[model samples]
Target: MIKKSELNRMADVANDRGVTVWVEFEGRRYGVTPPAATPPLDDTEESDLDRELEAFKAKNGYR
Candidate 1:
């Protein structure tokens, strides 16, 4: 886990710039963004997209 102080500093910069902060750990990268910088998705639209993705995955034989 990242240190709290470092994470706080990164969050401050990201919030100020309206962008996301990326960190790498254990060979993987993660992003943290302020909620205000992200747009909310409509539930209906999200469900429709999920259904479409499931259908595509099934058609492609992805388990």
Candidate 2:
């Protein structure tokens, strides 16, 4: 079995490069890839969502 520290290092490398990382164990090869970067929400859309959230929070009496 691979050590926890080694697995963490592999994950770090994959995230830094935004590429797939693979490892072999027993007779099988396993791989992991970082998720694609999501585009930022438009300013107007974000503001509208924020307003909606605030309204919901107020209605629910959440601070």
Best lDDT goes to which candidate?
2
Candidate 1: 10-residue stretch with minimal lDDT:
30-39
After superposition, which runs of candidate 1 have C-alpha atoms over 4 Å from their true positions?
Answer: 37-63
Alpha-carbon shift of residue 59 in model 1 (angstroms) = 57
Q: Which parts of model 2 are misplaced by more than 4 Å?
A: 47-63
- Tell me the TM-score of model 2: 0.64
TM-scores for all predictions: 0.51, 0.64
What is candidate 1's CA lDDT for residue 42?
93
lDDT of 1 by residue, 17-54 (tens): 87899999999997778667457899999999999999
Give one digit per residue, the lDDT tens place, for model 2 in 1-63.
988887888889899998899999999987878878999989999999999999999999999
User: Which candidate ranks first by TM-score, i.e. highest?
Assistant: 2
